[model samples]
Target: MLRTILRREHKNRWERRAALVPESIAQLAAQKIPVAVEPCSIRAFPDEAYKAQGAELHNDLENFQLVLGIKEPPVASIAPQQVHLCFSHTIKGQPYNMGLLQKFIDQRATLIDYEPIVDERGVRTIAFGRFAGIAGAIDSFFVLGQKWLKMGKPTAYARIKQTKDYPSLSEIKSELAQLRVTNDKPLHVLIVGTGNVGKGAKEVCQWLGLPEVAIDEVLAQKAPKSSWFSVASARHLHERIGGGAFDYQEYLQLGKAQYRSIFDRLLGQFELLIQTPYWTDKYPAHLDIARMNENMQALPLVVGDISCDVNGSLKCTKKISTIDEPAYSYFVENDGIQDGIHADGISVMAIDNLPCELPVDASRHFSAILTRYVPELVKMDLNQTLTHSGLGKELQRAVIVYNGTVMPEFTYLQHYLDRHKLTKPSEAS
Candidate 1:
């Protein structure tokens, strides 16, 4: 029988999310599963809550077999032969996390990344994307209020607060409901994508009394009501350069080289953009830098980059800001960044961990999805051949490294890791 431990996250002091909520633990407790949660100082769920649910809280990990975390664990804290589960964020061969990956290799520990955990159809099984969208939307509104205040035109949104300041999503909505734009000009908000993240963002937009409109309605010359928002999915976002009907599979195969985003054409139509697309290197740039310069005077002033992929999809998303300093200015003229919001440039809210601002809500949302797979996750047996085990296969497929060796699916990362160690010898520890 595998003994699982829910470890505390120490990646950032502000990172208060937990891998499993107390409600999820209670379910495991009812089944008499061998699992324990270490007391954490900053976790959204208090130690008393887990204790109330019959979960043992402690700092020692000597007896635990598997450790679950929200983020990557510190290299020094990982026990040898321990099977770890978390969002390692190393699939991309990120330069900063190379040392952490190397530590796993040296320690003979297995790493099962949550980001890559997918079902048979390859849809991600666990995520905090929706909460991220909710937080991103709220923050974007706050940025708008700040910008308006700086311009000496205060609005009802000026009374709005940060996501963490609110106890729950309901309270956030209550505040949004009271918001009334001070000016006669309508706030034309464009939300990109329609996934879980987009849905959450849309919820916030709707609660703010923003009328949701279709893509065709957005292109109309007539302006929306004082508070209105529009949603655009993949069909409305891009077009085939060769002028044929867009095929999703063909687009994926051909990548960005074939598809061009039509998003820039309607740049001046909206005042704010709430981006929620899942971006990768293979995807086409959503907002072209050259086109943005050409339409600088007409472009949106505020951009809520919910995807938060630094220098990935959106050209203006030059850097990932923190919750403390969530908004930054992207100057189109100089192609440079200002630390905070500036009247001369467009303000971008691109905090990478937007979900962290609403830690409790995000944890609960994440736990709902993760709890369904806990029974199968805890049944994973390292000693047995993964091929013969039914429950273990789910976890086995997500395992990037097993017993210090790179798994078959992740073999390509070997060269990247080798190069990382050579360039930065200090990370070899």
Candidate 2:
């Protein structure tokens, strides 16, 4: 049997989530698969919990052949011929994680990224997206409350607290259920995307007893009795650049060449905008810098970017906020950011790891899905070609790197690696 270890997450103090939990460890133990866990003080599950499930507590994982983590591991940690499973965050050639990807190549290691582990339909089989949405929605309200209070205008949102402050998701929902918007000025919220993240955000809105209104209704309402929200999909946010109707398939295939964003025009209609969409440079940005500079006054009071892609869809998301400091004010005039809410400019909540705010819940949910794949992952032979490695289509498709070589499907990343090498100080000098 292959030796496996659940590595500790050290990316941030707030990253307390685990790829696997005690319950899954117990299942593996029942099958005679010995599991090792690195001692972590801040992990949602205590070391003793894993120990109870017959997991070995180890500090050094050098002996472990298979390593599992929730995020990208440190560059120094990659060992030759080892298999690593984690959210590598390098699928899109993310510049910040390019070094980490290169480390995997240099060490002759195999990298299986969880982000691309999808079914035949190309939908991700396992992800923290729903939890991200839930925490993001909660924090959005919290930010809105804080921003309003700073501006000397208190609303029902003022009573909401940050997602991390709550002990559990149930408690957060219960508290939100009690909040009542007594002010006559109805709050209109716009949620972008109708995926898992959007559904989770909508769940929070429903807890607040907010009705789902049409975008037309939101635009027509001069004064409303209660707070309401509307959801928008790609069709709602974009249009054909030329004189034609929006075609989703065409936009997906041609991206920016065929479509353009109209999201900026709708910003002023909502007090809050909770964005939860996937974006790449190929697509039109929801709010480009030029549009943002021109329409600063039309910006929403609070933008809860659950997608949290810095400078992705929403250009105002200049940087990713952390759990400790979950918000920043984007100054339109100077194109500067000031930590926390302020009276001037828009308050943006752009925490990249929103799921980490509810670590316990997020871990359990993730572990449940990931446990199904562990048995197969540990049993695979790294020496063989990926096609003959016995991994199912989902896992096979996720193998970005196989023994120092980038998979044929992901050869485009080589361009990014070459670009990084050219830009390196040593090469440039």
Candidate 3:
């Protein structure tokens, strides 16, 4: 029933990056999907403006299908506004759409929760269930990340070391008290990987009440952590006076000696290294990333950069652990080449839900991705299955609505209430 779709303009810096994708790659995306480009905007909404000729939003719904670029929550309630999503609504603040509205509820789903240390199912069962309300959004690839994706930029894992400069016991105690986490020692941590993910990791460390260091700050200084050392970018080495590939030995002998002295001249303070994994089609960054790891055969490291190699693959099983890794990615990935850490290396950690960080700002445009496509989505999803009958009685007993509203069961209603609370009353109202 749908034929043409419009790609929204990239307004945000991140979106701008996503939009400027090279022609070859854009063609590759179009290989199977017959997608056409048009600037999508919510202004297309029927009542949006000076309607001297007040008209229906769609002049021809039959021919053109509006495809929401992003998936938004269902708003079964009235007067939709600001990421509006709902099940049922009240006229006098009382149920207007009942049982019919409840039908849309996706309830009684088992939620997969995990704790590092556990028994029963053992720690292996890190994820295997569902829940009442799980926040879902378009986080697979950030707009800026899309830019980097198209650029095929290099990624690295950054690790910051904690040295004497690290907070003392008193300071650690002071900060821990604020976060409600208690520790005997100052609790040194290493964060690796660079770019956005690394920045996010530093923020998380700060959240966990730990000291951190980034590579940029370290690189600027003469005395980096005495313990671990980072080499140089492989890409940088290529721009020599003559311009020919240098052999490993000659490369080492000729390049900055800082890398060589790293091991032998340990800065006297490092326990870990966080390195990114992404390497561009360009060889320099890749070789640099690999060489750094090859030399430091001792210190522990946490590689946060999930994407590396051609295609920016997320596969990590090749190195270790096959739990397949969770989508924790990055909550707010930023290029944190500064602050947050004490160690000396750029970090690379994956950050998820970048758009949601400021959805209102993003909503300004993401809504375009959604509003334009929603009707088709609605029509397309008309026959698509959504209910989870597998839950059985737990569903019946737990679910309050199925093609209706008012699921009193906590397994259902509680979640709806919680999500509604996330938005301002006027918006969610």
User: For every model shown, what is its TM-score relative to the native structure?
Assistant: 0.94, 0.95, 0.28
* Model 2 CA lDDT for position 169: 88
Put down candidate 3 lDDT per residue, 170-252, tens digits, no spaces. Answer: 44224323542223222223333333444433444443444444434444454332222333333322444444544555644
Among the numbered candidates, top TM-score falls to 2
lDDT of 1 by residue, 1-429 (tens): 578889999878789998889999998777777469998888989999999888888688756778888888887777777778889989988877777888878878778899888778887778887898899999998888788778787667777787878999888877778764534346789999898899989998888887777777776646555567888887777899889998888788887788888777667888789999888888787776877777888878899999988877778899888899989999888878988866658889998888899988889878877777777767776665555444555677888887677889998888889889798856555
Which candidate wins on lDDT?
2
Better of 2 and 3 by TM-score: 2
For candidate 3, report its TM-score: 0.28
Error of 3 at 392 (Å): 52
Query: Which residue window of length 10 is worst by lDDT in model 1?
Result: 384-393
- Cα lDDT of model 2 by residue, 1-429, tens digit: 569999999998889999999999998888878789999999999999999888989988777889999899988889888889999989888877888899889989899999889888889889998998899998998999888889888778888989999999899878877776534347878999999999999999998888888765644545254678898888877889876888888989999898888776576678899999888889999787788888877788899998888888887899999898999998778778998889777899999989999999999999999889988998998778999987988999999999999999999999999878777767548
Q: What is the lDDT of candidate 2?
A: 0.87
Question: Residue-pair clashes per candidate, as listed?
Answer: 0, 0, 69
